[model samples]
Target: MLPSLAFLIVSCNLQPVSAAGTDVVSCVFPFVFDGRSYSSCTKDGAIDEQLWCGTTSNYDEDGQWKHCSLQEHGGSSGGQPCIFPFVYKNQTYYTCTEEENRGFWCATTRNYDRDHKWSYCADIRLDANPKGPCVFPFIYNQTSYSSCTTDGMSNKKPWCSLTNNYDIDLQWTYCEPSGGKRKRRCEGRWGPFDTPV
Candidate 1:
């Protein structure tokens, strides 16, 4: 049997830290899953699992070895979802719902239209497995779309659809940083992209 895994909820246990000049409550715990350690869920695959956090497994005779991001143990049960920082085609992705939260959910892109349902990663389908740091799709200008990993802010212009396969007018929105008017190119098929202007 492998080591027992546990899900540590930081909100349940808070620690006090000084930030700026005021005391702030924080809960930052090292995630240890089945003897594998993870600091944050950021990198792709298991070996690079240490990208956000470090994890090791002794399942093999080689002692504690880092597995691929997707192969790492994340949920409490083998059938449960894997943790964040999973890899797909060598790119590290995060699946958590909130942009700031990091864990197994980052491995797959959540279904933004489906009540925060995480059912796809890099366009691939996932059933019940939720562990992620998954790649998300880029939908722009109501008609352009692409994957976040593939699009780049080239020529100071937003990355547009590279293929004719994507249809414009699907649903596009402009994204601007909070309190700023400069819009950055971003994509999502069915949502409003807004910034505090």
Candidate 2:
């Protein structure tokens, strides 16, 4: 009785399809299913094909075609929507959407490196102000600094630091000596430092 019950469980999990000839041609890597390309292939049977993520092919303990594990998205559960947040440099971004299997959505942010500032995600609805660059201010070793865009400047650079000590709401200022005393000589292309009027 136990053997019969086990056979029924196994049969219910197996998908039935019309079997073709034994010489079935396996699907190639990056298999396109429902218009999306999968990175890997699992089992290649006469009647059905199983494709997933990772390498182009899968191997079994006996060196045969097998199904590789599916890639798991962050915060995913029971077919529910997943919004995966990732931080780069210092800014936060999200990925994945309510729709299943759809690829990442694209958006602009200040979390870029020296090259680009755009990233792909599932959605960008959470972005309050996508048009403007994101600014991040931080303090280190009793000195405050800010990272902001230089769009309107003459250089048209993406990132530049405030010349003055950074504050949450205070105005920016140039780096000056403390106690109104001239320490080391200010030497740069801007010429010698002059006392503020």
Candidate 3:
């Protein structure tokens, strides 16, 4: 009888560590993120889809495992760096790292003048390169345009028009100087008017 009692004591002491504590429910898919392991299966009668091992102190409560809230344990993809040459408002923009440290930002080529359109440069992970082209405004034929590609005056002709109202087609006619007096010969400049001749 004493030997049987000693054997029972040894058997109880030799129980598995997990058996001594709470039992974990089997999960089909498990994933780890942000130093936390999560299972894609929920506990019995649990409304939530995923279950976190850290939710419960013993990972089980009254034979029911705790489920993780979608709001609390949902994975986040925020805080990602930005990419360069992105188009905003129909214009291409590039990132500048030098100005990033100074609290400056990245903006589209057209938005370089506007202060509000710029976004945090560091968020886009821009690389510092002094030689990189920076957007600058240029005047051509009494019109203002912004460009980061050309260093100096571009060889391309400015989209000059006779009137301010112009479209993408840029359909306009060029007129030659009349030397202060209307030409006697009708050469495309004259319109229907009462003449004293």
Candidate 4:
């Protein structure tokens, strides 16, 4: 004799996945198998789609799975050291680090004084050396400073803080007026900061 529809479903397409858990199989077609909805094979039943449920305590924390609300390639704060309250393309997202789950800091707040359009926050570091040409208003202590004449501080103590700490006078390369050189480089006359380098 043919069993009842529900009984037939349980026997054929749907089955309890485990004895202790409520998880069961509903359908095999289209890859959705969770038994949350009635079998689509039945009349008046719409196709049930699969929805991702976060892992429970039963699952290992490291092995657990969680659904992300952000779009693919979009920003998120699932990790630590993430940048908070960040917006992109009209959508707000928190910058997260996949390394160990952390939040990110602002570049401007860290004395960057530049754009803040980065996707991650853990990229901040002190050993960063910029290649090629760069704009000014940069911050540097002593070891990083190469020259000081451009900023109008030849004595090095007045311009750079590194020399001031040592209290040493900078050696100034002066040009003699009787040397017949009409142009002044660093000695008597002031140079133009507005001049393009």
Candidate 5:
């Protein structure tokens, strides 16, 4: 399985028809679906098992969508969504990364060098996955969250901390439901994560 990126065919020339007739063609990165923010395409709520993405930033609110590919994965499980072709450190990233000891992370924007926006993929495993350093069962509100939670933020996006105890470290990032870690800087005043476009 690929990490971060929602794999798409290299030559995709789809002409999706919209009822509203709005002229937005390109897919919106890190869009919202079912209240969870996504940085890539997903099949979570697909009609026929095809990977699809919202045309606008919020599918729940806008209901605009288009096909990504023709029913790839044969109905396999869906994971966190990530935007592809994102730039980081002068390099382009098409999949998730474990750089800097951060967990499976993906740039939340098209240019990480400018925005510095990113998030960790979400994993529901009982124990921390051996792949990276993201601490599982992190504490929030004195309650342990083995997976990402939307309760901590106003946007209701999924997020988790780097340490086993968010109460102490306070380092965390919004998480993708696709697989598993995007640690935001954990310190000082709490602020909202910038929207990924």
Candidate 6:
């Protein structure tokens, strides 16, 4: 007398989430639950192995967690964000996808079949620290910029890319102040490739 799998899944999706209708809260890496340490999201205590993370740095104390995507240790790890239209197993994906019951995941690189880098999609969206590691070759004013720029400005403030390809995950970052540090770290003259486009 069990419900159909599809029905159950639908019901689960309909359940109220504490983070619903709010900006996705970034997961606290290396959290703890049940007297164990977990550097990534876990399904341990969650029904149906749904991935979850602590609202605070420690789960044991907060006891507050929200359902996250079954991402394989996703989020800013290595600063490699998901790139759309990614090639995987001779196929291309324009958005998040599920492979072998691992829930929705995306290739952190443009060619997953090559570098083989990927992570689970976030609970709401594959977004965190929106600035992200600069992806370069990004479009700002309908013009593609392969590197940081201070174009079309009066203050000469430095700027950089946030999206990988502009055509995919096309978005920019906040601040004209902290933007320089991100550029230096990710676009410096030497060893400035924490993120690749």
- Candidates' C-alpha lDDT: 0.29, 0.28, 0.28, 0.25, 0.51, 0.52
State the TM-score for model 5.
0.28
Candidate number of the best lDDT: 6
Q: Write the per-residue lDDT of candidate 1 for residues 20-134, one digit (tens) a residue.
A: 1121111122344444544333343333223222232222222222212333232222223423433444543333322333322333322222223232121112222222222
Candidate 1: stretches off by over 4 Å:
1-65, 71-110, 119-156, 159-197
Q: State the displacement of the C-alpha of residue 104, model 1, in Å, after optimal TM-score superposition.
A: 4.3
* Clashes (N, CA, C under 3 Å) per candidate: 42, 4, 1, 13, 15, 2
Give the candidate number with the greatest TM-score: 6
- In the range 25-141, model 2's lDDT, one tens digit per residue, is 222244433334443342323233443221223211111222332332222122223222223444432332222223332224323233233322312122211121122454323
Would you give me the overall lDDT of model 6?
0.52
Per-model TM-score versus the true fold: 0.20, 0.19, 0.19, 0.15, 0.28, 0.32
Which runs in model 4 stand beyond 4 Å of their true positions?
1-50, 53-97, 103-197
lDDT of 4 by residue, 1-197 (tens): 32332443345564223221122211221111132232112222212322222232221122222221122121232222323323333322222212223222222111122334332332211011111111122233333333333344444322222222212323222222223343221221223432212
On the 0 to 100 scale, the lDDT of residue 69 in model 6 is: 46
Model 2 stretches with alpha carbons more than 4 Å out: 1-38, 41-46, 52-79, 84-197
lDDT of each residue in 91-149, candidate 3, tens digit only: 33333323324332345233443423333332113111111222224333444544321
